[model samples]
Target chain A: MILEASDISFSYGSHQVLEDVNLQLKPGMTAIIGPNAAGKSTLLKCLSGMLRPKGKVRLEGITLTTLKQEQLTRQISFLPQEFNTTAVLTVYETVLLGRVHQLGWRVSDVDTRIVNQLMQEMKLTDIADRYLNELSGGQRQLVAIAQSLAREPSVLLLDEPTSNLDLRRQYEVCTLIRRLTDSRGISTALAVHDLNLASRYADWVYVIQNGKLRCGGEPQSVLTETLIAEVYGVEARVTIGQETRPVITVLGPVPVASSDFQSERDAGNDV
Target chain B: MQGTTANDLNQAYERLGRRRLAVVVTVVMLVLVSLFLDVITGPAALSLPEVLTALFQPGSVSEATQTIVCTFRLPTALMAVFVGASLGIAGAEMQTILNNPLASPYTLGVSAAASFGAALALVLGSGMLAWTTTVFVPVSAFVCAMFCSLSIFAIGRIRGASTETIIVGGVALHFIFSSGVAFLQYMASEDTLAAIVFWIFGTLQGANWQKLAIIAVVMAVTTGLLMSRVWQLTALRLGESHARSLGINTERLRLQTLILVSILTATAVCFTGAIGFIGLLAPHLARILVGEDQRYFIPLSALSGAFLVSVAALITKLLIPGTIFPIGIATAAIGAPCFAALALWKRRSYW
Candidate 1:
């Protein structure tokens, strides 16, 4: 199923966060990359139906607003940028809760099986009984990913999924997500900060700047030095690594007088 | 390759669940035993067999014995169970929905309102309805409690039912009612002042079959309603945004649960006066014993609350030979140290 968003606009009170943003998510990993407060999270929230934007967002030609919350959640599983819990839920229990919509007084065999299989696939079986609060940051991230997959959703939206992880854990988690997206034929869009990681793992990239979609295409065409200098206000060298993905190396910050920086700063003030 | 790991993980998870279930069952049994002790340990100090015989076979015992067991002990003991269970369930859900560990029935000022109503009847109902004071106090308390909670609900609805707004509204209500209660205390006469203080101290002396039945029905309804939504409530522990992403209407859930908590707290506090600590302490103990899985947390919270109050009732009997101490005093006296110990013992930061 393709998640198609057209003319989507969202605002927080008087401050506009997303303006007429249009995008499509097909089966495979798509990365929404941008600077801080660039409306990447807002766009994903709009696409996932977590936040109702102005225009129509359709999943397989059906308008998202027409579906009930339960139906929408079953189709699109979303993991926010900051997913932390104070509850002393174990790894298995946390994942099992992804099936909360279908659960009754007694947890069914199917729910348990899905949770168990997801934990195993995520290699989280070792910490199945560990409390979520007690786990390491990387381990907790894996558990969260496992939880998102436990829904078996066709479309997965993750905001800053690797923000809390170390460098190695980031690579491993992105690789696992890419593998899962391809193998399960799921449309996975993640809002990421690392441009090179997005270039490596994402089949498609959407760059958001100042509450608008700046560019969207294959990583090689989308992550050019000019696009980075325009959107990020930073000088970067984009080189094709041996793996045929654009590897961006940041050189220095652009001057404060740049037009993009002024617009980004103005947008920040409105928020 | 995944088969063995999945099976092993399944078994491990089940084992943990079974352990939690065992803890719940044990706490339940403890409540029953405490209830029995409370019933038998009154002024007469009847033997176990005597109490049991009087309870089961009324014809076999003397009329006075039957009256003591049936009229006095049974209703009082059962009322403690109902009140404790109601507060426990309400407190657990309150904490969950508000996402605050300190939230309880009293936090919303329902108990304070009830105390004010009881004080109003005690201080004002002197000559006009002297004979009706007995019924009037409880009725006034019930009405005030319901009014306070409904006011909070209405305010919460108007403000969009966000957690901060609801909590702030509750705090504002709490201050308003507490001030009313304080003013009532200031103007009360000497004899009526004692009565007002006693009512605020909280006693189960007014427990009877009628009040017990009403509380029992409310508890059953709220507990059943909360039980049906256990998974959704558990999902909330992951935080509001996460729960919403999982398709939960968190605002609606909070409002509905608030209404249910209001009814539960109002009914529990009206007849019994302002029993404290059990609401705050029971859920924390339940969380310690069994994590936040509402399947176990809700039932265990109720049982632990029942156990705490039942034990407090027994201590009230045992404290002095012939007279009963006010249960609220006994509960706070007993609950404070145990809560401190549990806080010290559990190293995990549940909040």
Candidate 2:
């Protein structure tokens, strides 16, 4: 396991957000899926060392709490959901900030090479000189991914990487993340809201509900109609695709009052 | 990959080289101009050649010109440069750490607290409490400034405070300190009252070699120390959580930076009274010139601040034929309008 959490629990004062969570992650793409307020992002924060957990996190035989921050950063790169840069930094300069973990004060020749290569690979070369605020949502997402990849960390933690992208851009970002993981053998853990996207891309899926892990396995095993209905409080149907992955479709909630519908129909007839 | 890497490397070098060249040229030109202009300012008219000869060879010029250049004008000019640089760098550090454009030493109530401490010392007389007041006026000022900053920081650390909350807290603290100084001024003796008032208005007239030496050594050492931590400061610009993920002890950095800024501000205030706006203006000027890279911003801000103060002093000296105005008045007169213009211009661009 590249990262492992043992009986991790956390709370904001008396309100518990995560309870007795145990997780072990290996070198692959693991999608964390859940309803809102399920502590998916919180777990990711703990794993990425952004927040301290109640229990221990161990990575490569060293306890995470004991390791220096910079050392951990060298191995793990985290992309938060939102960021604001007050400085009018260009795309290239912003991405180069990712390399700050490796290069301290001065930028070396190798650092420049890595940043440039990442920019080209991310298809941001044309707009590299443009300020960050000038970019579209999808373009900014791409630049953000490029920045996360700048340090060339062993693991990448992304919090809803595709949340802000449109349908087409969503696929493009997921594909890029998938390719980076597969080709470079980089470990990735993504918190995703879109179940279908998670099902299509995730090698492993962990379902979380009410701050506890509900299920953890392959996408086909973890993503089911019963689990979805129970966790999300919505009626949904799941169909297994030809590719052997599940697709979920939300149906309208079970009708509770026929009288209200009849009254609406009578009112329409009167009009 | 190798070819592309080489090309990128070359481009990075060229960009860095151009920026470095621009900064170097600007700094050198500004320093030369400031030095020449500063030497010729004073009531006793001495030509540039006479000032230079007096400076180089003390016996070459008359006693009056020599005393005027070396004792009065030179010390004031140097003090202006040192004090201005301290304010500029402190402002840059404050803004970066707070992650707010409006965060300056003054905005954070650092200068106000320093002024309050100075006022207290002057009104109560340094002899009242020998250890606390007399020997430690600067130390007391430093303590008060740090206290004010820490309070503002604590207010911001409260969950759900937008940047505006901290700014509001700073403004409130400013009013509190200003009122405190006013209270002190109310009860001061006639002799000490004039001195206190003049001090509050700020003047370089009391600038002497001993004081200038203290200001220079303190400002240079503090600025240099802070400059060495530019990488850490840059990481900090990403916010505390992000900085911690990058292996920085964010709280520790904050504490250290707060102390450094307070010390710098206290040192300047102890010597030059309460000179406003240098810290506010210099950092903005440096940011415009050097981009937001703190490594370049730190030193550039220092140099630009020195140039600004020196120039301001010179202009104030030459403004009237026979009368000398306080440096603080001239700086405020110039700084306020420039600040207004910049605000209007930056309104659309500031995010």
Best by lDDT: 1
Two-chain DockQ for each candidate model: 0.73, 0.37
Candidate 2 at B99: error in angstroms? Answer: 1.2
Looking at model 2, the pairs that clash are A69-B247, A70-B247
- lDDT value for model 2: 0.78
* Candidate 1 regions with alpha-carbon error over 4 angstroms: A257-271, B128-134, B158-162
Local error of candidate 1 at A262, Å? 16
Q: What share of the true interface contacts does candidate 2 keep?
A: 0.25
Per residue, candidate 1 scores C-alpha lDDT tens digits across B1-351 of: 778887898789789889999999899889988888888889986788888999888899888889899999999999998888888888888889888777777777878899988888877786565643567788888889888877877876784467667778877887898899899889988878888888888898878898899999989998889888899999999998899998899878877888888888888898899888898899999998899999999999899888888888888888888999899999889877887777777756656
Provide the lowest-lDDT 10-residue window in model 1 chain B: B126-135
lDDT of 1 by residue, A1-271 (tens): 8999999999999999999989999999999998899999889889989899999999999999999888899999999877777887998899999899988888888999988877766778888888888888778778878888899999999988898888988898888888889989999999999998899999899999889988899999999988888777887898899578999999889877456665866788999
Query: Which ranges in model 2 have alpha carbons more than 4 Å from their true place?
Result: A251-271, B1-13, B126-143, B150-166
Residues A113-212, candidate 2, lDDT per residue (tens digit)? Answer: 8887777666677787676667777777777778888878888898888887899878877888889888878889999999989999888999888889
In terms of TM-score, the best-performing candidate is: 1
For each candidate in turn, give its C-alpha RMSD to the true structure in angstroms.
4.1, 4.2
